[model samples]
Target: MKRLTLIAAAVAAAAAMHAPLAPAADKPVSIGKLERVATFDGAMPTGVTVTETGRIFVNFPRWGDDVPYTVAELRDGKAVPYPDAAVNVADPADPAKGFISVQSVVADGRGRVWILDTAAPEFKAPRRGGAKLVAVDLASNRIVKTVVFPAEVVLPSTYVNDMRFDFRAGAEGVAYVTDSSLSGPGAIIVLDLATGKAVRRLNGHPATMPEPGFAAAIDGKPLPATFKVASDGIALSPDGDTLYFCALSSRRLYSVPTRLLRDPNVTEAELARAVRDLGVKGASDGLESDAAGAVYAGDYEHNAIRKLARGSTTWRTIARGENLSWPDTLSVGPDGYLYVIANQLHRQAGFNDGRDLRRKPYELLRVKVNAQPAPTN
Candidate 1:
């Protein structure tokens, strides 16, 4: 416990020393204008979600960030810890009881907000009680359920990236998540929400791994360093029949039936055969599906958001420009708008020759669209 305290203290000190200054003027990277919803002046925000009632929530992972809260609700232009600050500050030794390190938050159609706690900051091994899925009652702002991923399911190398719920499946529903581990095999995890039983499907499958010979390039040049992001973005089809996904470091999109993914009797080879290569959808960081069967993908390398309509042969650019430095996540709001977060992930020191090139006021922008997210089912 003392050793962990020292490390946290050291990190806090380092973040204070490099507190973000006023944003530096730089060339804009927008195709069409994005209406600003909120701004993160202190820390860089990676994931964003908006409820049907327009409640906004965002997360700041503990990756070299001095985040006061891991998950928060943005209200009145400021972030307040959702539910309460106490749960957000759960004892590191007993994280399952509280939020440890939250990577994503989604307000499910069932009127509840789900929090995905990576628990293992800096991609470190997840301690007991830290790596779990927490569901909060939006009406009460109270935690109602906590589902911890057992060590066997959340391997030491597992980095739970993103998830989507399919209410059409099972008694309560089922959740599909991407295990985008940087140092271990990439795969997909299926959790039976009603029973709290989870299993790894397509573990180390090719569909979940980074493409061979993949290279993340920007401005016609290879990024300064290798950015091998495995299956990072995932979305379920409107009918709850298909699940679309792509690796951050790869350009192609893939899909498979949700029924096939949830069946425990399905063999590995059979599951592999069911996987369909949906062809190239650009190098995307997040995937979101609308009720019209159109999938939105944030093409990070191109600073654009493209859409693949149902039965479409190729991707069509919906928005693009210098205003989107590195589009990180996509969410379709209830008001028929698509929201995105441009956190300048590629401009970070790791990809910029070891120099922090991120600008202040990392953006939370949205564009009006003619679609709503697929129903929870």
Candidate 2:
């Protein structure tokens, strides 16, 4: 896939591309073990979602992997294009016309799978129609609707990473997306589902940007400075009142009132005032909220998942181990199990001196939990 070559050329910041390896921790933390659900011998999978009926779906970004399909349905322990292979094929001339690079696939409780298309393969500049939100009818396996962001909304440097849906927000629903742009400012993108209007909020806010002195380490070595990823993970409280977010390179968690974030009238200054820094919770890549208001965070550096309960000042590790390599995105399935993607992203080619270091048989694992998807429409 030439992803390493593409990323190196895309960043063009040689200074930020190389770094020294840090020392590994002496002992590994022990929590709970993850049960293997499916394995991918090809491309590394990131996002995972299980429908109320126990339908499992996953996505693979064109991050240098030979992904036959960007989004797939896991059936009989294999990944098959959900809707069809044609939808997964991108139009070379116009990548936005089809799925170019998919970063996340979310199954809202309302029986629909929402795919967040970054549209910028190899982390290149985003095209006008490249960044979009596509909703597929789970029952019919057909695309029901699409929402494309305008250039002004999804800037060239924007890398739409993850999203959460609040079906109760607007007439149809509302979506909160994170722009984890490595080379530009990071912010939250809000979408009014009924109108298909997208707005950028907290643009370049301190909370959304990568921590100044923080860098994620893998195999006892820190990633290049250019590997800074900001505002990559997001989650919603059970009551739809609070929205939690974190930077891929950060250890602290932050939150703001959904009401303030949804209110266009709330000025940026006001929204900043509403944001609360919830202290450190380990360097994380993804966050998921359960019906009980507990937020599950993926601690990438420690190969663990931590749970932060309502009103808690500290995070408690729920799962951890060497097998949980680079715990990427997390989903609380309808079957009351936490599904996680251990794609070994830190072991990818980009971080391994331009040599693909990802091992075979990427895993989709689940651990039994007393959690359910947060209520949606």
Model 2 over residues 1-377: C-alpha lDDT tens digits? Answer: 69998786556433212211233453444566679999999888889988888899999999877888999999999999977999998887875567988999999878799999998878988867778999999889999998887667787789999999998889899999999998888999999988988889899998999998987776577888778888999999888989999888788899999999889899999999999999888888999999998999988877778888877776777787778888988999878899999998888777879887778888998888878888875
Error of 1 at 190 (Å): 0.2
Worst 10 residues of 1 by lDDT: 16-25
Output the number of the lDDT-best candidate.
2
Candidate 1 structure quality by residue, lDDT tens digits, 1-377 = 99999898777544432222212233323344577888888878888988878788888887777777888898897888887888887685676787777888887877788999998887798776578889998899989988888677888888898999988889988889888887777888899888888988888888788888887776555764455666789999999999998887788899999898998899989999999998877788889999999999987767778888888876766676666778887899999989998898877776677788888888888888789888885
lDDT of each: 0.81, 0.85
Against the hidden true structure, what lDDT does model 1 obtain? 0.81
Off by over 4 Å in 2: 1-24, 92-96
What shift in Å separates residue 290 of candidate 1 from its native position after superposition?
A: 0.5
Best by TM-score: 2
